[model samples]
Target: MKIAKLSLLFLFLGSFLFAQNQKFTIAEAVNGLRSNLAVKNISQFSWADDGKSYYQSAKNAYMVTDLASHKGDTLVSLYQLNKNLDLDKKLKTFPRITFITKDKGYFTQDSNYFWVERSGKDWKVRDWINIDKEAENIEMLSDNEGFVYTVKNNLYLNRNGKIVAITDDSEENIVNGQAVHQREFGIEKGIFISPDNSKIAFYRMDQTMVGDYPIIDWSVVPAVNKNIKYPMAGTPSHHVTLGVYDIKSNTKRFLNIEGDPEQYLTAITWSPDSKSIFVGVLNRDQNDMKMNQYNALSGNFIKKLFEEQSDKYVEPQHPLLFFPNSNTDFIWQSQRTGYNHLFHYNVDKGLVAQLTKGDWVVTEVLGFNEKKKEIYYVSTQVSPLERHLYKVDWTNFKTQRLAQGVGMHTGILSKDGSQLYDFYSNATTPRVVNVINTNTLKTRNILSAENPLKNYDRPEIKNVTLKADDGTPLYGKIILPTDFDANKKYPVIVYLYNGPHAQLVTDSFPASGNLWYEFMAQKGYIVFTMDGRGSSNRGLKFEQAIFRHAGETEMKDQLQGVAYLKSLPYVDADRLGIHGWSYGGFMTTSFMLKHPDVFKVAVAGGPVIDWNMYEIMYTERYMDSPQNNPEGYKQANLLDKVQNLKGHLLMIHGAQDNVVVWQHSMNFLKAAVDHGVQMDYFVYPGHEHNVLGKDRVHLMQKVTDYFDEYLKK
Candidate 1:
């Protein structure tokens, strides 16, 4: 499938000859770009049982496009019929729908749910089910007999014409249905239901012991101070426990796992028979993890099936499937062999058979086909910079590629796993969805391709592998100007967020800053980004190697990255600058303070000056509590080292940023002011953790001007 949209700005030789750094037209840049770009992170697509595809196209409209249709004349509406009951009239706007029911006819919008049924050419609102109070993220059970959902912290079940509240004491201090900040960082929800719909398992986070970070919401008169339970590095985390509730018995039992409640209770799953629940528990230090099975009825500890120990931190995902007809065999992902691999475990025997072993990381688990004995997944096996669809045999650990694409591939499998709608793309390839028959592994339909960046003459971004001082192969991207000249000694802008939880390198389109980078590069400056040490997706040790020394090791890798950049003949070592946001902001601040001479200019947005000021959960996980590791926290604190700041610095933040609280910026502003340090700062009122929409362009302009004034010679 090929999308013929116009690439953003035309690579006009005249534009370059004019010597005017502006090559990419923002209109052409944003025009050919897919609207999906704005909605990609939120939009979801699901394949119907009969193979029809349904997805969200706008804020409230659900589009049903026939993959079999070559013309792409798709049916789009609000997922509901017109108010006047006419098929030709426009559909009424509704609140955004989140999770869709397994039946595909119904979907949940906030707390209310409605079903659509086809009546000839018109779609009718078949049923509107309200489970009372404001609910969120609702989904029907696999049995289709009831629904499981979350309302704030409470879990609910609506079945047999009644709404059942599964959890009662779901207050601010005691959370049951929702995931914590860590889960948000990990990008996974914290609730699941048993296949039979008889049992529901959820993560209950006890934040009563956690520290409350104050975020003053200034929109209100006199400023209303809101206490948000945010656990930062070196602080006590929220106590977490797993609980199972049985609907028939009206009983709730907490699992009998022994450990610090403040630790992480992650990757919860149920056995196929619904008789037992499996959990992956990682220690607070995250160096050790244990996989245990618990008896669902008695809430008794069945056994510790497996244990994975790492010198660094351990990351656990949802434990793999335990096929119903088979024994307690599951697939678990581990980086014990230095590369992430899948291991098939026999729980009863306590034996783990390595399933998929190689030098690649399983990017994500798509699904498991029990009947076909195939484990479908997306992996970086193709290349570290790209993802591909692959299927592995459950019995033999043999793997086969399902999609042939030299880019990132994400797939949605059919209900029966017989077909898949595969989405593939790269820096150059706009997103294209292709329907394929998984059984025959043949492309059935070329569906939709949307390119939002078609008209922009975007600069070419090339993925490069640079070795760290320790010989760790680090992946990064070099973004250059459209009129780049190797003969010129260009200033270098090092974009970094070398933290443990995030990765920056992917086969995706460059950011809007590519234009800014292009402008800088045209002005004889080079822009680069690297996924340094402590960045995720490699494995436990590679990431947690920064443990207890959060900023130290990350800085080493980034410094190595800077040295690598210096090796380029066109790069000017004396004209290096760095910028980052949040943890990246913390990195920027720490780097600028610790090695002031290395950077000419720096920008830190929403930085954490001191770990002691951070919340309890996240801070303690990495640095332990200040009461325990005052020295580690002190060493990582940017405030103490600010005295060494000799570089030009710019601090930017959102006034309403609850995550890093504006005080993080305010504190640094005060410290820098007291020290008589020259600094520039900006704040976006009414903005939260991020600046978006039209403000983004203005922010970009501000960034360009600041960097140009400070770093450009």
Candidate 2:
């Protein structure tokens, strides 16, 4: 008995020592999740038009699986595709195929679009169209008769093998078929095809009036100056207008929008009959919006359907979603009730009904079940950190949860809205895919990804909830160092981004938070991240709390997190460090200067030192114009607060950054010199707002080295 017990003890100790033998390299800590340590997932998973089967892409084949039989078959292979095309060069891998019908799909290869159809036992290419090699922002017609694309500053349409120039602007400042307003207000693409595919509406932005800012390319021997149009707050902004091109007549006309030329036009949509177009016209102040319709062919203004007004700011991010079969009524997402919810409206009746209501917000609208008169959506009704699918009866406004699991659930609905391809992940679950029946709420697990970090020694992460100054609940996470000792105190680093439209903490996979945090924890440091006021996923009140004063409330809430850390027995309050990028970079710099005594070390990258130099659309909405809100701008400006710095500060910026511009930190250095303040500065050449790619490992290593040199000492 004694001999057996000794052997068991030896085996246990060997396992424990083996687990502690592994450590993360800087490269693995930075890019491991995206490369070698990436979790398995279904590639190009989508449902067929019949709603009875789904498809996924494999090594060199397209696979289709029947729902009832749970059996899969090869729909097409790279060999079969190349055999049908008879091309000079064969494809090395299967292209991304998107199905428009049950047995028909299309794929693009070398600027050529091929439509493939499945016969009894083989797949064949039915048609093919070749486009320009330099084409961008390509949008194909619904019937596949033609497509539209942009080349440089002009727009072109290829219809029935004929290329037609839609716009012929001589100057480059007049960009056609491109996103304007710096891609604000949820405008991603530039071209919008009509329902009948007979006409196309595109944005024409004239940026000649905007000021020119140079982004120097320092990679060459003689640096080249690349000037970009940058409109500062309260400055001359770009003028954008929409133009409709009729494919049949080969003619175009600009919309007759009766407003200031600089006003924003968003939420663009088309009528079912293709005779009218809808646009949400917002003024320069961004306080009010009018949903108006226009005649498609003549560009004549029709009646205004409705108007929405807000005291803070009216941000319309989503276009009107018309009912599946009805054109007169549609669903509009609004935050009027403090949370984002859906409201039904009619063109003539104005207000129809409020479909979903709660303290939580609806994140997305999946689809509609026309036969059952039900609408499918994903919402935060369970928790702010979790998203689940829900179905609601439009007639009675009764709602029911259809998705299982307590995590971030995202799904794609079939054409008939009967099956949902649900995908989700949580702290304990790496990934889980399910096919859920909407009516019966029956779920079948398709894929449950294994944890990629099972062999590594991970740190312990616990959710931390604290109260704001107003007693509002603020969520965060505290990552304890590996082999933590409660009796021994350790240095702490706070990584935060407390900016608008960003949330740092969530109940997702790799629950130890960012691997970099875990990487630091293994090196004997604790890491903490919190989402304070001005962060997204909360209600409008939570986000707008920092309005007019960008840094005041956010700092206060972050202090709450600081206080919580100081309360812990294992935290060394005197050795606190902080790091962030972009707006978070702005916050990190603000904290170092404004509250210098709080942190011992700080690293800020691509930070905005002055609000006045930021863009007009985003800055004016939060701080108003620099002219109107001079006091707010003066207080938030970090350049004036440079002399207050007392900690070891390292400021970094990208040489080619156009978003925040390099002038922000350069001017701050000028102020630092005048005040006789000592600080460190670094620059990454030939990079943008963020340092990406393999160089990201070097960036994070530099940040880590800075923290280790200052805080660990």
Q: Using TM-score as the measure, which candidate wins? A: 2
Candidate 1 on 1-713: residue-level lDDT in tens? 12323332344555654544335433223322333333133256666566555454555566555655633333435544564355653345653443344223665544456666556566566456767666665667776666777777778888855888888883668877777655532527667788777888887878886777676777778888778787766656678788888889888988898987766777777888888888777787766888888898888998898888865446565565664366577777777887777777787876567877777788787776667888888887877777899888878877889887577798988766767778877776656667777778888545445554444445666677877777889988787755677787878888888886677888765442344555555555678988888887776557766777778888888877888788889788999999898889999999888888899998887787787776654676677667777778779877656678888988889887877778877888788878887778899877888877767666666777788898996
* Candidate 2 wrongly placed segments (more than 4 Å): 1-21, 84-87, 125-127
TM-score of model 2 (CA atoms): 0.97
Summarize candidate 2's per-residue lDDT along 1-713 as a digit string, tens digits. Answer: 99999999999999888876567788888999999989899998888888999889898988999999999988888888778665655667788888887578898987988888877777787557889999999999999788999999999999878899999999999999998888888889889999999999999999999999999999997989999999999899999999999999999999999999999999999988788899999998888999999999999998999888889888888999988878788998888889999999998899899999989989899999888889999999998888999999989999999977888899999989999989999999999999999988899999999988877878999999999989999999999998799999999999999998888887888896688998999899999999999998888999999888988899999999999999999999999999999999899999998888999999999999999999999998888888888999999999889999999999999999999999999999999999999999999998999899998998999999999999998
Question: How do all models score by TM-score?
Answer: 0.85, 0.97
Error (Å) of candidate 1 at residue 21 is: 10
Quote the lDDT for 77 in model 2. Answer: 88
